[model samples]
Target: MNINKEENHVQSVVRAAHILQLVANSDHPITINQLSEETNLNRTTVWRLLETLEFLHYVERDLPTKGYQLGYAPYRLFSKNNMYLSLIRKARPLLEKLRDEINETVLLSVPKHNGTLTIDQIDAPHSIRPINLVNRLLPSHCTSNGKLLLSRLSIEEFNLILDRELEPITRFTITDPTLLQEELNWVRDHGFSLSLREWDESENGMSVEITDNRNELIGFISLLGPYQRLSKDKMLTLAPKIKSTAKEIAEKLS
Candidate 1:
């Protein structure tokens, strides 16, 4: 084919790929008109591309909404590994970099139904670092990751969860719902969370949320280490670095 024709064909393929991605990431199924508006293409061209994608099982159209959504083929291709595993894989390098920079134990965590769960961790390269709590459920009232995730909840949801007895995990743990709310409020305002020896007197954690493109909190990255060295002032100083690392991971998720 001529160079001009070949270039036009490649551009068309790129546009089609963009269309498939838009359908995959949309919050809800999207209509042809919406796709055209988003892609700056006419309805006829978008419809032709959607027809080809539907034939290939890359996307499917909804009868009721007349909208397009990702098809089973995409899930089949991605299901080789679980989503969490993929996230961890994508985040490992960033986590390692953060740990090396701060020289503190770095952990990745996501919120659970009743509490928060640690998904992955990299131990600090120091001799007397904090305990590694991998694949463990942690109390939400005191830990930095827990509070950072909790800060995403609406007031009513937060109140409902806090209605239970707030057990004190350590001498410094916050056992009062009102006081914890204040802390969570501060976390939301400051864009980070602090454990301050609440989970364990020997360890302190500083955390920031990994928010997606929509600005929704999906997970968080935290730095935990010996409280003697990772003091409140030090945590504050490292907060920006941790937040930058989390932002890098979040962009990958997007």
Candidate 2:
């Protein structure tokens, strides 16, 4: 790749990015012809763009279905940012407020290289009990944080994760990849995720994704506590508040 030639290829790169965005925005896989028609770019140009993207793992072709979908590059790029930590710092006060309000543990998580990682938490303040979770890497398939992150992926990417074999951490945990994908679909549709004794046998967790003004998923903020104390009704009530707080934080950060 010549330097000037590569610089001149900005048009190609932009079109390729647009193609990825198109695929990501679609609820189902799209064919190359569909992409070309949608973009108003010629077939050859679109094919070249898709080919380049596929080579970089930004797009993957579904051979059996003969459609293309987003690949790992988008996830990799999203996970590489340091803004997640900065967001955590800004979220401390908010987390404290939630913890105080609910008298339950509050956590902030961002997607890491291979799984969701807890970057910050506020232990509930109370006279009788307090749960401490400062730094932990929860199973991506068995926790609320993991579900929120996983919800951002395309169907193909979600299947890729399931193909990796989701391991069960507790009896309530979902170990089947297909079953977990179904749960994730519901989570995405509902705008929140709940883990009932999934990761920890005694703990129940509820999480909502943090997305920027452009609807780009940044991370998630969650509440975790003993299952007995955080009942289903309570979780349902808190879910909207959690999601609202996340949006507020994202706006402030933006």
Candidate 3:
């Protein structure tokens, strides 16, 4: 997505790939002239690349109208790595929409070992929004998303997570295994978790689990922000909305 690339990045290939994407995104087949005008490339160059893509069955060219459409190659390439990609693609747009509704940073995360791993984030435009935590392993015992994941664990697995040293990441972090286990039980009973600065002193986080068609836990959708804005009570009130959005995302996988 970064247009400003390194010197080694080939311009022709990038342009061709962009054009191919443009075609794939279009609702209908596109003309060569439109592709040229959109990319600001010469008609001849666009034609050459389209011809190559068509030959490889990565593009479908209309013989009579001289139009082009996205071919099966792209779908085949992506569908092979479907599970995570499917979840992310379906979750991202909804996460952005939820960010607009609540005006808070939203995140999608999954369990990774005994921790919560953020898969995506849609940061609120507010200057005071919490920092993005995508790809980070959040502490399991003290974070809302982490506890949401841990609450779904089997008895043996739950014991394993509890057996690990529950170090305090922040002043408010629950370092006692019994207390953390009690919190997880509460989360399981209430169907949601809202933590007040257990990860960071000034921030609060809320999480709701997403389930598959079979009602199995898939991941979690979370909101993160300053305690002043996302106070425990305020987050508690938003819990239903967050769970609703997570359910909508679950429906997509079915």
Candidate 4:
């Protein structure tokens, strides 16, 4: 048995994982020199490992800072983990309660890059409810949950998304950047957002922000239904209850 060769392979894997961890834990992009100093590996070895990790999208180079940050791979893995499952599990009862109270579809969504990813959903009792949006990445500018989540991003991050051509999902969708900016400003100030037949001509939704104990935005809870049943006035009237429900879910998760 070539024990030395096997040991070398294992050592390489361990060093790579250590480098990835350092990048993940950093508050800002981490330079290769910082990784090498922390890992006690030589610069060449660190660079080679980083090259492999970057190729696999486990780490990505922050071009502006010339440093490394976590790539898409970790987030994809995180989405499938027990922790993510635990979040859904802990919040399910409250979501169900909200749905029962309002008899409207309830959606749980989180920010996914420039969009919103619906993680879980509770369908409304009415047969005429909106279609299921679970496991879909919908445009942030067109959905209530998307807008509420986007409102929590830093100004630089928000601008990056805004710089993209905002696609219109429906005639009512906010394709005008200036108007969208105004809408998001209102959402940030009020801690909620509304989408009146924006994503779909037949459906309307209102969303409330969910935050952790530190008040950091984590996700959103949205109530959706047919436009006839969930008119703008009705949604505004129910806003307090929906916001309270979101707070309960956040507390449960925290």
TM-score between candidate 4 and the true structure = 0.66
lDDT of 4 by residue, 1-254 (tens): 22224454787787888888889778679999998788777899999999999999999999999999999998777777644577788889999988888898999888777688888999977868766677678888899988877777788987888788888889998988789889999997887899999999998999988888898878889888889989999999999998898888887776
Could you say which candidate leads in lDDT?
A: 4
TM-score for all predictions? 0.67, 0.64, 0.66, 0.66
Worst 10 residues of 4 by lDDT: 1-10
- The alpha-carbon lDDT assigned to residue 231 of candidate 3 equals 87
The sequence of per-residue lDDT tens digits that candidate 2 reaches over residues 1-254 is 22223455676666776788898877567998998888887889888988888899988998887889889887677766755667877888887887888888888888875778777878876543324454466677888888878888888887788677677788998997768878988997889999999888887889998888788878889888888898767999888788878978887789
Alpha-carbon deviation at 242 in model 2, angstroms: 0.8
- Residue 248, candidate 2: Cα error in Å is 1.4
- The clash tally of candidate 2 reads 0
User: lDDT by residue for model 1 over 1-254, one digit each (tens)?
Assistant: 12224454687788788899899778678999999888888899999999999998999988889899988887677667655888888999999988887778899988888778888899877878766576689988889988877888888898788778888889999988878888988998899999988988888888888888888768889888888898999999888888889888988877
Give the clashing pairs for model 3: none
Task: Estimate candidate 3's RMSD in Å.
Answer: 10.2
Clashes of each: 0, 0, 0, 0
Model 1 misplaced stretches (Cα beyond 4 Å): 1-82
Sequence-dependent TM-score of model 3: 0.66
Q: Name the candidate, 1 or 4, with the larger lDDT value.
A: 4
- Higher-TM-score candidate among 2 and 3? 3
The lowest-lDDT stretch of 10 consecutive residues in candidate 2 is: 1-10
